[model samples]
Target chain A: MTDTLIVPTFDEPATEAAGRKLVIICSKGNLDMAYPGLILGAAALGEGIETHLFFTFWGLDMITTSRMENLKFTMLGNTAMHLTQAPKMPIPALMGSIPGMTGVATKMMRKQIADLEIPTVPEMLEQITQMGGHLWACRMSFDMMKLNEADLYEEVEAVISASDFMEISEGAQIIFI
Target chain B: MPTTMIAGRPIDVNDEGFLSSYDQWDEKLGAELAKLIGIDMTEAHWAPIRFLRSDYPARGETATLRRASTVGGFAIKDLFELFPGKPAKKMAYIAGLPKPKGCV
Candidate 1:
């Protein structure tokens, strides 16, 4: 008896369409944590996927009108920052705790992202929204921070509850950043 | 190399059922495509599809969901409701355009 080999082609239209929904949850507020959500969201939108970003907890600061442009990067407790920025001669961890070091690090990092032509957090938020990605602020965070809708950037579609987000994110590939 | 008959006309489509040529697209063809996907064409569905068809010829790219929502005057949620999951791909496919670049 001859054995007939049957190979199945896995690249099907249904599978391709099924993987198209992406929901990104941004739970961290710092400069380092912020970019992954925005960058991935932007990339997803560029690829014609239905993308939504849900900002909660500290991440809520990213969509606020005042805080969006002024996100900070603290070197203290961030060993990765010290290693990457000054690889040959790493700064002492104690120096990172010095006052004004965070401000300096934030400035330098901002310059690096700018020099690389990467959009700032504010610009990335704008571009993502303009390109058809949805930006939603968490209502719990908004209320906890005593921030009104007016406090968020106009690009934010709504200040939504977890239930609302769940409704929209149903059947989506959820990513937490 | 596959062909689907729409409104008594033969239209070429790819193996996965996307139209092979944008030239063969018409309102009737779009409606037929929507039907194949189990969607009945409504004004809401037509809005983005029409926008994509016209917008693509000028821009040479697929409109992002946000662009479609803004330019087509529909809310982003409305788009999700209209196209369900994978609205961007569904809209591009029904619009008789190539699978939008960057789309997985």
Candidate 2:
């Protein structure tokens, strides 16, 4: 009988104790809404953690340069005001169309971040990517929107599916914003 | 009572009822601040406070409102911002915190 020592092999060892995987899901076009996830993900990256931002649905719109530069505060389509009082309510599309509503919401959001000293979405993304955070664009959503690769920011890591996002999200702090 | 400025606005340290100065934050002051924001300075919350204190301005100087707001904003926003696909909610309460007695 041959006696041999058997050692289990794990593809990704847990050798790095301090590193963490954080995935932020951005589904809004508002700069205010976009900033927090980008900034936090960047901060996590700065701390040596592995960070990923999965842009899906409306969020895919924000990551694309074609729309980001012209991003609108679409009060005409906001569903949150009429939605149930659940914390994660959507902005009412009808209300979003109301005159001045979009501007009001936009200004309010900007002011709040100003008061809190949080960076804007463009600024946050610029810093986050420069700092090494992995950014993924949802392929299905991107396709649904008909956005081409050229429409996206230069730093986009890849256009992947939800399953890929789920696989990346495992073991990481998942933030849906 | 030491008088200081945060973001060019004067804040009285005495009215805050603690000996914390611009340089170092007193542990007791941190506890009071945590309470004012309705946060329990427990294992989960203490580290952030410690991190904030580390950014406290040195004596005879003040931290930018932009910088200090990060700490205050995170505290308020964490409790408030909760929209789907939205950033943390902004808090008006942070701006409403009582100013030092006799100093607006």
TM-score of chain B of 1: 0.84
Please state the CAPRI-style docking class of candidate 2: incorrect
Query: lDDT of model 1 at residue A89?
Result: 81
- TM-score of the candidate numbered 2? 0.50
- Return the lDDT, model 2, position A58: 82
Compose the digit string of candidate 1's lDDT tens values, residues B1-104.
Answer: 66766667777777666777879999887887777676899987888898898888887777766567546676665666787655677787789886666311
TM-score of 1: 0.59
lDDT at residue B22 of model 2 (Cα atoms): 41
Error of 1 at A21 (Å): 0.8
Model 2: runs farther than 4 Å from truth?
Answer: A1-16, A70-97, B1-104
**Per-residue CA lDDT of candidate 2, range A9-107, in tens?**
211222125445788898887664666676667555544467789998888867888667545454553444532246676554666667887677677
* TM-score, B chain alone, candidates in order: 0.84, 0.35
True contacts kept of 1: 0.00
